[model samples]
Target chain A: MAYTISADGLRKRYGDVQAVDGVSFDVEEGEFFGILGPNGAGKTTALEIIEGLREADEGTVSVLGLPPWPRNSKLLPRIGVQLQASSFFERLTAREQLQTFASLYGVPARRADAMLEAVGLTAKAGERVEKLSGGQAQRLSIACALVHDPELVFLDEPTAALDPQARRNLWDVLREINTEGRTIVLTTHYMDEAESLCDRVAIMDAGRILRMGPPATLVRGLDSPARISVPSGVLPLDDARALPGAGEAADDGVSLVIETRDPSAVVAAMAARNALTGVQIHGATLEDVFLELTGREYRA
Target chain B: MSTWQSFRSLGRAMFLGFVRDKGALFFTILFPMMFLVIFGGVFGHQSTSKVEVVEIGAAPLIDQAVARDADLRKTLKVTRYETRAAALKKVEKGDADAAVEQRGGTLDVHYSAADQVKAGTAQGLLGSIVESANQAKSGVAPTYRLAAQQVEDDSLKAIQFFTPSLLGWALASAGVFGASQTLVSWRTKGILRRLRLSPAPIATVFAARVVVSVGVALVQLALFLAVAQLPFFGLKLQGSWWMAVPAVVAGVLAFLGIGMLIGAWAKSQETAQSVTQLVVLPMAFLGGSFFPLDASPGWMRTLSYIFPLRYLNEAMLNVMGRGLGPMSALPQIGVLLGVAVVASLLAMRLFRWDSA
Candidate 1:
């Protein structure tokens, strides 16, 4: 399959911190690829490196079959990017802001109004950017990114800080863009959002990918004991591990939630030990998988 | 897109954004006007103060005394009127600041209090001269008959001296603060980062700014000249006043470069504004915007030469206020150009698209 973005052995460092350590990934054409990670996972650093906004200390990246760094003059025009917390020129109307970007790309100014319409900001097109609501400004930002109609798009937290309805509305816009056969690569901490919109997701942590696969496949590959919930210190620390099917238990502040294969056998043993007062059994989730792998809870 | 096309599009968009910004609009149009009105009100004409003193029966006697006593000729301007009614009419018409009538060497001073400053000055000088002239009534033998003659000297209005410095400060604040804050704000807002991703050159945006600044300065120059000529200001156009055109352009170039350097070095808009204040406040004070520095301390006058604003203000004054031609203003122009070149180079070296 043809790939839209390909990177290998990407590395970047800031003084003593290794922001992105040897990250490698391939996003195929027309695929909705998502990079899911908790805070400080180096997702944004990697995305910036691929977008050519930043330089990788050691790596090679190709976008649309053209090198991005040292500036592929022709490559920038063919790609779109929406940065996290992206701001715009003050006092410019939403339509005018979009048009400004379009003009820089040498595209028609009319495309700005069209994209505003596409993002359902047509009514607010004439409003100043500073006057727009959070959701409206976010849509305007996306519209500016897509005003040029690039073949590939990159969005870093496209719906971050948006109200639920606004986020849902933006998701529909992203889906429509995908329906047009354009490839997309985005980063988010919301696993459900990734599960719903991404064809394939990469779970990243500490600058490395812990797992990469379809969300369903990744979840199905996990053994039984989908999810376990109990108060901390409910069972003797050593005793819980000695149970029939209990794996390492991780406490996520509120409760000690652990992933295990055989939930019934562990529950029986815990009940006999009188440690089942708050014990509960539920289906496994991406959060459970993350806790089992990374030894840290994922942000809800 | 071709570079030309990119420039046009970006320039047009920036122009639209600049004009639509209410705060910037207020600064561009009303800020200088306010400064002019307030400062002009505080200090009246400083160059040459004109006072019309109508002489009654004392006309020929004062004329003779003025001719003989050179000191009297310098201080008192006695315009002889045939009748006291005619002299009072001139004072009422404001063609004269005060009226004076003399009968048998006892002078009666007639002055309108409408313009208290001018009238007070007239009263002090004429009041003393008339008191001394009446000494002949005090049984003191007259040593000799005194005669007075009037001659117009180099007395230009305070408004004439004030106009240039006010314009300089206006241009400096608008060019420096306006450009620097916007530059820093653009970086903080991610506007520069987004523009960097495009194929267009960022120079187009800055070029538009320079163009707008020069245009605004030129408009202000015309409006100021027209307003200052009104009866309120009573400013006289002396020497090569038109030479201020070049001075204004040079001023914009130098100050715009300084502003760009500040913007490039500042990490945020607030920092940029603070830095601009640091430069603007000092430049205004040293450049004689608030007060005349000609009679200031020697060290202060020497320090003024280091600031580009000083050159801009002095160049404009040489042409419009001081009786000097364009040739005399050459040194100011040369200094401004030198500063512009240096500042532009520094700005280019320090400018950054991403926030530090």
Candidate 2:
């Protein structure tokens, strides 16, 4: 398979900090790839190097079979980039902002209106960009990136600081863009965002990828126990602990929690006892994998 | 994408932004216009008031002239003093415009040099009075006669000087403040980074910005000329006044370069604003925008040459006010362009795409 992006041992440093230390990754065509990390995990730095916005101290990056550094004009027209901070020309309306980008890319003016509609910003098209809500402006920026219909797009923390509802709305927009068979590379600190959107994710910390794999596969690899819980009054704490396949049990006043490798077995035992009321089963997720890999709570 | 398309699109967007900004509109166009109205009202069509002359001793010539010419009596308000020292002290203290005494075959006129305009007017009136007296005493038909003529139309008023000087001031401030503020804000706001990621060349983006700035400056020049030409202001455009166009372009380019330099170096909008003010305010004052450099002290006149606005003011004044030929603007244009080139080189060297 032809890879859309190939980066090898990319390294960058700023003063005393090693911003990107021996980072390496490859993205397949049409894949929704993500670089997940905390605020200072060097995701933005590495993305910038690949986007040709900054130079790496070492290693190489190739996008669309061309070097991104030195600002390859050929690659520029083939790829889109949405920076972490959404910036528009001063005092421009939402539609005008997209039109300006479209024009810069030599796209037709009509594409601006279409893109605005696609982003569900047609109603706010006449309003100045400054007047747009944070989510609306974020949507406008995505439309700007996709206005020219490039085959590949990069979004740097596109959903940071957004309300939950807006985040979900933007997720739909992003998924639609990816559904159109465009390769997407995103950098985000949100674990659920990476788990849901990315085909594969690289979890980074202190400027190095600690692990890289599919979210489900990574979670499965952790081999962590699942927790099954029921309302406190559903069963006594001692009775929950004695249940079949229940490795450990505790009552935290609200619920009786049982840690077990076989969650189904514990649920069956609870059902046999008519104690399955409000039962909730928690499986291992990417968050758990992050905690296992870093040996600390996930801060973001 | 073609550079032309990028330039056109970006230029249109920037122009829209500029026009929509009421603060920029007021500062760039109306602010200088206010100065023009104020200066023009005070100085335009100004005629010298009666001169207070102190007569020292034995000035029978002046008495006879005043008695003979009714205009002289009205023009010169003569006060007599017992001693020449007292008369000279009156002139020195500005209580009298001039002190005059008869010195065998010649008349001595002592005028304070503080007010060049008023002193020059008094000296001219007295010299003419002496000339008429000499002519009357000779009583012979003069073989030759001296006739005085104005180089420019008599309609030229003080508005002519204020228009060009104030226009130059306006253009300089607008170009510098506009460029610097735009650059710094764009950088801090991440707009520069956005443009860099676009397919449009960075050079094309800046070219578009420069085109819009120059276009706005031209509009400012046109508005200033039109307003000054109104009957109330009485500004008469000279034969080569069109030369101010090229001068204005050069001046804007120079100021833009300085602004870019500040923008590239400053890390924040506040810093850029303060620095631009530091550069522009001094340039306006030292550039003879508020007053004529001819009346300035020798040191100040020399200092004015260091400012680019001085060249712009001088160049526009040459063609628009003094009615000098277009060639007179060439040297100033050359200096402005040279400054533009040098400052641009430095700005390029200092240019940063991001505030970080």
Per-residue lDDT value at A59 in model 2: 99
Clash totals for all candidate models: 20, 0
Kindly report the docking quality category of candidate 1: acceptable
- Fnat of candidate 1 is 0.64
In angstroms, how far off is B33's CA in candidate 1? 1.2
**Which TM-score value belongs to model 1?**
0.79
Query: Model 2: runs farther than 4 Å from truth?
Result: A297-300, B48-146, B150-157
Q: Cα miss at B248, model 1 (Å)?
A: 1.9
**How much of the true A–B contact set does each candidate keep?**
0.64, 0.79
Let me know the DockQ for model 1.
0.45
Clashing pairs for predicted structure model 2, backbone only:
none
Candidate 1, residues B222-325, lDDT tens digits: the string is 88787777777777787588889988999999999899999999897778888898999999998788778887899999999888999999999888888686
